[model samples]
Target: MMAMTQLQSGDRAKIVDLSRVSELVRRRLLDMGVTEGVEVCLKCTMPLGGPFMIESCGQCLGIRRSEAMRIQVERV
Candidate 1:
């Protein structure tokens, strides 16, 4: 598994694991349909190394760089 932050725009991957983040964060991600085995795509990232736009389960989310690094993914 690799950190989601390593992915570039247009990259596709399947969620492998979520880091040992807080319960609230885990719940929030799960609520948003970000779970293991789900495929997600990196749509784009903000300039100056900011948030990342990721698409998953027909929903688009702008996740902060720090949070995104906690999401581990494998190339699909």
Candidate 2:
């Protein structure tokens, strides 16, 4: 498994763990259909350490790089 931050734009991966994330952030992720077992595609990473845009369950969500660093995924 690798951190979500490690994925390149257009890469697809399956979520493995969100254990390192805070409850508030985890809840937000869940509300956006991002959870373990879900397949997500890295749409793009904003320039200069900005947020990352990911597509999960057909929805696009932008998340902070810090949060992305805590999400674990396996390339699909």
Candidate 3:
């Protein structure tokens, strides 16, 4: 397993788990399609520390670094 930040842009991976920091945050991610076993692709990371986007289930969603660190993934 690898942290989401370690993946390069365009890399595809399966979500493993979300950190236990916040239940609401985790639930929100799940609601937005970042569930365990779901495949997702890193789209792009903004320069200057902005949010990054991930493509999953035919949808692209942007998430901040703080939120992303909670996610663990494995290459697909």
Candidate 4:
């Protein structure tokens, strides 16, 4: 498994773990359909270490770099 932040644009992965992040972040992710077993794709990454744009469950979300660092994912 690797941190979500490690994924480059166009990379596809499945969420495996969300335990490393705080409960608030976990809750928000879950609510956004970013739970374990869900497939996610790196859509876009801003320059200068900005938020990452990922697509999951037919929705796109921009997550902070800090939260992305804590999300674990396996390549699919």
**Stretches of candidate 3 exceeding 4 Å from the true structure:** none
Instruction: Write down the lDDT of every candidate, Cα atoms only.
Output: 0.87, 0.94, 0.85, 0.91
Model 4 per-residue lDDT tens digits across residues 2-74: 9998898999999999888889888888899789999999999888989999998789988889889999999
Summarize candidate 3's per-residue lDDT along 1-76 as a digit string, tens digits.
Answer: 9888899999999999876437887777788977889999999999887888999999998888777777899998
In Å, residue 76's CA in model 4 sits off its true spot by: 0.6
Candidate 3 Cα deviation (angstroms), residue 36: 0.9
Where is model 2 more than 4 Å wrong at Cα?
A: none
User: Candidate 3's error at 54, in angstroms?
Assistant: 0.4
Better of 2 and 4 by TM-score: 2
Tens digit per residue, CA lDDT, model 2, 1-76 = 9999999999999999999998999999998878999999999999999999999888999989999999999999
Which residue window of length 10 is worst by lDDT in model 2? 27-36
- Put down candidate 1 lDDT per residue, 1-76, tens digits, no spaces: 8999999899999999885556677788789988889999999999897999999988998878888888889988
**lDDT score of residue 75 within candidate 3:** 96
Q: Indicate whether candidate 1 or candidate 3 has the larger TM-score.
A: 1
The prediction achieving the highest lDDT against the true structure is 2
Model 1 spans with C-alpha error above 4 angstroms: none
| Reference-based TM-score, model 4 | 0.93
TM-score of each: 0.89, 0.96, 0.88, 0.93
TM-score of candidate 3 on Cα atoms, chains taken together: 0.88
